[model samples]
Target: MKSFKHTIRALACAFTIAAVSTTAHAAELRLGSGFGDNHSSTRAMRDVFAAKVEELTAGRHTVSVFANSELGQAPEMVNQAQSGINFGVFVSSAFFNSQVPEIGVTNMPFIFSDRETAFKVFDGPFGEKMKPLFEAKGLVVLGFMELGFRNITNSVRPITQPEDLQGLKIRLQNNPVHIATFNLLGASPTSIDASEMFAALSQGVVDAQENPYAVINSFRLYDAKQKYVTDTGHFFDVIVFAVSKTALDAMTEEDREAVIEAGRLATLEQRSYAAADEATNLETVLSKGVELTRLTPEQREAFRTATAPVLDEVKSRLGAELVDEFLSAVDAAK
Candidate 1:
């Protein structure tokens, strides 16, 4: 315990040294996210997170937000937070695997059938277990926001079954678990940063990509000619709302409470918005002349079967006991 507190204090010193405040007000906490300005996550950051922080702190502290990866790509922004240049970030849990592999427990293919079970498992002991892993690496887990279930999109043709994915180049987040799932289904998966995805699709750098409807619509991928979508819902992704332990410790106790409260409120609001907006986003995409394919239970089962080995793969990487514990937690929740 003494060593842990020492670690926290050392981190706070590093952050304080990086950004020295001169005026009566301390440097505004910079919060960054990879989502675009129009995305719900970005909106939550602006209206709920930033606003609530100021409200709770009575204007003594403030939060400044940069949307659309304005701070940098996922890895770059993550490094900045660790270095104490930023206070908090909203980034995909997949990106943090390089730092904390246990995060992949949530990335297993077809693991979640619906939002209720997903939230039950994540908001319970599984979430508590994951937080300390992050703290050990200099990040404080503020909360987890829904990125929602990911779907597949391409210019070629509608994918009605798992066989249709064979040999096509698909763009996926830089997650090994996702890559393994797609590989088993016989697709060539490439890792592309979200910011560069539009160009890659327009130039035919990759033939298809998978993301939630929010991403396809908000990022305007249809404009890049990705007009066909299959609602694969392969993985239920989460956005980790985390603060750098360095920056977190630099704040006054009251200020820290404000940040935590803001994160909690924003997370709840964001989840509600995310759940309700998927239909609206799908409507917007259909209005753009994008072809949508909704899979049947049997068809989705084919996918579930093909990607089943991904569980074993993840267990190999993260450990069988831990992975089984996560699975058992999901079962208990169900």
Candidate 2:
């Protein structure tokens, strides 16, 4: 895949450059995501999101969807959307932490028990409260999709407790809170961009990594020799669907409405797809002979206790008032 990217690198660059052209259609939106072509999120973007945009706008606008970091890594594509280089982005909230530290509140370890609780929190008022933070950074918050729970996958061994992670070098998303969580748990964590994770794991630069089942299956991390998986369910994460505020501001009201509607419908469908496919994705890894470990109630509690200080640390970094408000909102959602 890396070679393929390099082979057509110049042509893909031209296509992306053309995708953002202002002389074209109403929005001519270029949506970029880190999901691979076979991933459900990619399917949602191409089949549902892009189709809805063109249909709602009567073909006056169009979306060109790029997947697997073909456009750029998560943060780079986000920067592109913010700068109007692209029209929209579908990426993990962890990438947004750099811009809005308050968003880190959502990634607190062992925060939610299941996917349903997260859905209620994000789809309700608490989700609304996080929008302004993104808007302030030049991105329009459209809707949220499930990135779901993160778990550990390694070539080393099955992780049954917090101590099992000791001395294991894990590839974590570029989030400070995540790094802190792993550090306290006794693992050496590195911030490797998801785009390069497989290579890093395959080449033995890192012995282990963590991701949701969708990412694990889509990236085929098992092929890189990461065959042990533990169901930690540490952080229930969300994928932020957003567009450039600058581009939206310039769009005609009708075109803007179509774009927003496309995002809304796509987000709804993506969450539905994520919920159903998660079990199937786990089975996929297991079929390939990857070992699976489900942490027991007592085991999960141990992890929760170890990572508890991370919450206070983040609250201190991003005002206690805002973080506490987010916590209150989560409680309200429950």
Using lDDT as the measure, the top candidate is 1
What's the distance in Å from true for residue 135, model 1?
Answer: 0.7
Give the per-residue lDDT of model 1 (tens digit) for 49-166: 8899989988877889898889999888877777777877888999888888899889998988898899898799988999999999899988889899999999888999888999
Off by over 4 Å in 1: 1-20, 23-25
Model 2: CA > 4 A from native: 1-22, 25-27
Q: Which residue pairs of candidate 2 clash?
A: none
Clash count, one per candidate: 0, 0
lDDT of 2 by residue, 7-66 (tens): 799788888878766457545788898988877777888889889988988887788989
Alpha carbon lDDT of each predicted model: 0.89, 0.88
